[model samples]
Target: MVLVPLLRGCVQLLTLPIHVLAFLGVWDPLCKTTFPYFMSRFARLYNQKLHKEKQQLFSNLADFAGASEPLSLLEIGAGSGANFQFYPPGCRITCTDPNPNFEQYLLKSEAESKHLHFEDFLVASGENLHQVADSSVDVVVATLVLCSVSNVQAVLKEVLRVLRPGGAFYFLEHVAGDRSSWIYFWQQIYDPTWKYIGDGCSLVKETWKDLEHAKFSKLNLQHINAPFNWTPTRPHIIGYAVK
Candidate 1:
């Protein structure tokens, strides 16, 4: 019953080159090519649940907005287009990320979808999504995004602003652990170092509190503790919220 260490998880270590390059401030070109390529493989591997949880999430998303004439989705951190398969037919995707290096991989994923086409790829960060027009998109997605942003509140505000009325915000993210546990102490010690090499991922982000404070009228959120048993900072929240 031994779970793999967090450092060995597909996401925790992204790509060794990307981290070392990030540390050196000289790996952008290499990261754009190598990191995205490697990320896609690891992401899918890490996401293998005992049941089809993600499929259900995407199914619900389709039911909510898929019937419209032209449904659109703005994903906060569309890393290598990992969610492309889950998208229902005819959903136009607009992906945003601070690293413009992922453009090639995103396009590659778009082509692979053959169902969800690309709208645009914005070279922007989650906290500042000014590139997207307010109240324009039908759905906003942020899987594994809130954990890294410097200001989660600002990101929530932008997500709300960009979403059309009745539009839904879908997310799946990990967060801070219990205060009394040794895991919390480990997280405190490792967070800064982890954030540096793990692409700004904060091991102890209290993102559930931010989601609670958001102006969403309806939220069907649930906790995910079983699948992420591999790490102490592995408490995850996943579901949809309607604006």
Candidate 2:
């Protein structure tokens, strides 16, 4: 018992430097730099697995824009521009992300997506999109973003503010499972560590509740298990809400 306590103390002492660096914000930039690389690989696998669902979800976007007119799309948390391929043709996309490191990846993805036009890349967070104008975008998109936002309600409000009168907001997010399910229990257990490792992503956010209360003029949302190996992210909600 004494040996175990001594080893625990020694481990804490060994990790003191790392804690100090984290406190001084040295680790943040490093994490930001490395995260995009891993995320890009994961995005490829995730897109492949959820191709059908994404196709169905994105098919509805054609209704928002005419054949001749290009749609003005604002994507919040547009990491690596992973959804660019699914967007309607001739879309003018404005990408915003909290991580500036993703800009390079976004540019690469934009080059590969010939059907879409890249407008601007803003370094911003979903909770506060001060750079974007009010009612300026025809569509606002958020995928796998609400889980990491500090305030989901604030992000939703920002999404609504940027969208035009008859605009739409599309979201695909992993949410907490039912209260009585084992998945929910695992989510609760993994949430604390997941936040740090997953870069502030919460494993247990009931994002559907926030969307329902967001006051969208017409809300159409549904839940399904995403075709991914990660159990925490399996319980997903995907759909669009009209403003």
Candidate 3:
């Protein structure tokens, strides 16, 4: 038994670099292609249950923010552009992501949300959203993006800086839990491997603190204790607030 565990540790150690490269897209023979496709495919199914809940949350946010019509929306980490269909009336949504696979979904969203016709799509990353003007957006959405950003602090700062006064910052992300010993263990074991597989996804960060430190005006938070499929330790936290 000791030898078996030791051998497994050794295997993981040896494959660490390979896993990192694959997760970071450095070792892709297809040049960083197909990985996003695979990830989007995975998200399409995994996120289906959460979508309805998210729409409700967004509706709540719309009411809380009093966004009637022609609201400006900037969404970072626009994975698969699934949220496009949820944009409220007269909303000008600017969905952004570095992944080209999301463009088709964005177009589909544009077609679906006809009332949200004033929409734009950008191929970009959260680290540098230079295309968007500072302090110009009325609403900022960072749903599930903090878990994967290269610099969570920078992204939060950007979100804070861009959002106008009374504008809301909506997010629904998986966060580290207080009582997940099994999740903690799996996180320790597969944390390094997932970094390579999920484009720098981290199961360790306490994102709640990051949001708190952003210094928003009206703070609202809700922690969901749902177990994840990949691991039981990491619980998904879904909620939002204003700035």
- Model 1 scores a C-alpha lDDT of 0.78
Model 1 over residues 157-186: C-alpha lDDT tens digits?
A: 999999988899998887777777666666
TM-score per model over all chains: 0.83, 0.89, 0.82
Tens-place lDDT per residue, model 3, 1-243, is 374356547657878777666668676544346556775676666557677667777885455333444677888877776676566776677888877666775666567667775467788888788888877787888776788888878887888787777788888888776644566555655555565556667877788888888778877788776435656324776667677
In model 1, which residue pairs have backbone atoms overlapping below 3 Å? none
lDDT of candidate 2 over 184-229, digit per residue (tens): 7667766655665577899889999999999799999999998765
Best by TM-score: 2
The TM-score-based order of candidates, best leading, equals 2, 1, 3
Q: Is candidate 1 or 2 superior in TM-score?
A: 2
The 0-to-1 C-alpha lDDT of every candidate, in the order given, reads 0.78, 0.86, 0.70
Pitting candidate 2 against candidate 3, the one with the higher lDDT is 2
